[model samples]
Target: MDAMIPLAQFLWLAGALLAAGLATGILAGLFGIGGGAIIVPVLFEVFAAVGVAPELRMHLAVGTSLAIIIPTALRSYAAHRARSAVRADALRRWALPVVLGVVAGTALASVSPDRVLKFAFVAFAALMSGRLLFGRDHWTLGEQLPGRALMSAYGFGVGLSSPLIGISGGGIASVIMTLYRVPIHQAIATSAGLGVLIAIPGALGYVLGGWPHMAELPPLSLGYVSVPGAVLVGSVATLAAPLGARLAHAFTKRQLEVAFGLYLLIVGARFAWQLVA
Candidate 1:
């Protein structure tokens, strides 16, 4: 299409997109954290360069990020499943509530102001980073709560947050599980499985919500999800995810968490700067 010619001319931009995806994919697989921490920021920069409106920029970035995550998570999940690391029971218990929350969150996103959503996302990132960095020692999942309630609460929070922030929901879920004494590896594996569930509905919701606004976007887009961007990013990410999973075995659990925590802090600061600027 005529609209795509300009984008095609910018080969360097395309390379940047792919490289960002590759880095994020490795991080996602290694830490069991969704690539959202990396994806969102990169997307924001890319979209801005392409002249996307400020109001829709973050939403589109988040939506497109979720779109790519669907495939990446599925690929990672498959690999983790093969290793017998996925906690199916936990996934089943939390599925319903999480799905419900995803729908609710996505619907809310469709109508909410962009500024509100961005602020909320920043708050979430800060909270999650704090929990990972300082609260790790005090958290524990007691046997006292019913499985359904625990799953629902955790799933709902993840679902609600994913659409709003364009994250894969793995980081928060893993952190929660770790606090409750779940082995770090199992939590990471299980989070990958749950990420698929979060991404599916959330991605769908974004598409539907952004459909009316599609004509406003640049070429190679489906609503707020940029098809080209997703394709380029998702492809390499899928291949790299398994390698990350394999590397996960090399580090002690504490070291992995600390590394991930530092990553979060860095990412959080970047987003905070974006918000302020």
Candidate 2:
């Protein structure tokens, strides 16, 4: 209880977290991109600035970001479901495998070094961005979505990769879905469902794995999850998400992808700079 006073005193950090939530919430709605791409970078900087040790800083950032995704993803999922955009069949086939990957990825995140994870995030995000910026709709490997085995394999990759960078697995999932001829709207809707799967296990894994080290984290934290940070961020994210959904219908798909791609490039560049500097 007493620990929270310090958080209130840190006006800049509070404000920054709130602002980051607002932006990411809008982005989550606008791009169906999970907003973790932005939140991970923002929280990393905040934790660094607050003097968290390098060892656990990235974990905290990622864990807290996952926590934030819970509400945001569920909200987006419900909204998309109402629109009948969700493809339940594809999700049914991929959910189990993606869950498996989520478990494995969470295990990896619990042990890997910050620099190694950041580098991986940078590389993966850059590739995702490149595909968005330049990849064409018709460039697909097959005429239709893959068989169950192959689809599960791709889901595994998304589940594994997303936790490493604190995302909800939506970005990669949507990209793959769209590439294989899933309509962009359906892809976005399906990814929202995927995000829910990613966030639940991802958040629990961080909390359970890091419980022993909870005391080392920043104020208002439970294990790796920052209570106040997640609450503030989640609140704003939930409020702004509907606005983004409405706005999503206003823009061309290409325009949204381009913006998302540029944003990810910036995220990658920030981490790369941090790595070298």
Candidate 3:
């Protein structure tokens, strides 16, 4: 029955994608995570079902996921801002370096080998898990390490790495803010704001870098961004994200942290296995 369906059956696929996206979107908003943790795996399966090449599958998954995150992140930021969780002062302070870092990272990704990218993502996920598990009880020094210079360095590292893995830089942002003893609410809000910074250059890089190879892609694709898929997923995610923000208010901060940590562990394990295979 599955084999009989046409690959481009847009409506059915869109419905399924919308439902899945909504669920993940809510999780993203509530947990202050980039939806990439869920989106990448699902997108990989979706692209495979549509016959995307094995070699290009990860690239497409990452690109499309990042593309959708742009708007989703913006919507999440707005929602958080409404609650006064977004610290505009901090965002302003970090913006320049984060944007610059994203541009540099995106440019670098264009020239880097795919294997290196994959390995880097796996390593990142592992490191994140280790930090969360073992360092949960550790308090941040909170002494402020050279202010803007330190932030720029962290921002650059996050910008350079997130797009390559199809994320919105939220995970890294959360960790950095946590280590600096930023309040959880403020950390989440700041991370959402950073998503916009990350997505812009990352999306541009994917489009430009992958353009020459366009002829090899599936129909209706703009470089690596799958327009139809992005539309379907982004729409639902926007609507669902606000609900997640509401849910966040219902849970204790510590509980939310544990839940989010476990979620990352599962997703990280899945991606690691995929990379290994």
Which pairs, if any, clash in model 1?
140-180, 141-180
| Candidate 1 structure lDDT | 0.79
The sequence of per-residue lDDT tens digits that candidate 1 reaches over residues 109-166 is: 8888777667767777678667756764656767332467766887898889888998
Q: Write candidate 3's Cα lDDT for 1-277 as tens digits.
A: 6754546455555666677678767886788564676677677777777667777767777788889888878888999999999877768877887788778776776676666556666677677766666665466857443377777788778877888787888877877887777787888888999999888778878888778778766656777777777787777777787889899998987777777767767766766777678
Candidate 1 residue-wise lDDT at 81: 94
TM agreement with the true structure for every prediction? 0.83, 0.87, 0.81
Error at 216, model 1, angstroms:
2.1
**Best candidate per TM-score, number?**
2
Q: Model 3: how far is 243 from its true place, Å?
A: 8.0
Which candidate would rank higher by TM-score, 1 or 2?
2
Stretches off by above 4 angstroms in model 1 are: 1-13, 22-34, 141-145, 238-259, 273-277
> Number of clashes in every candidate structure?
2, 0, 0
Candidate 2 lDDT, tens digit per residue, 1-277? 7877576645656777788778767887898555678788777877777677888878888899999889878988999999999999999998999999999999998887888779878988899899989987678877578899899999899899888888898878887887788888999899999999999999999888778887677666878787767887778877887888889998998999898889889989988998999
How does each model score on lDDT? 0.79, 0.84, 0.75
Q: Which ranking of candidates, highest lDDT first?
A: 2, 1, 3
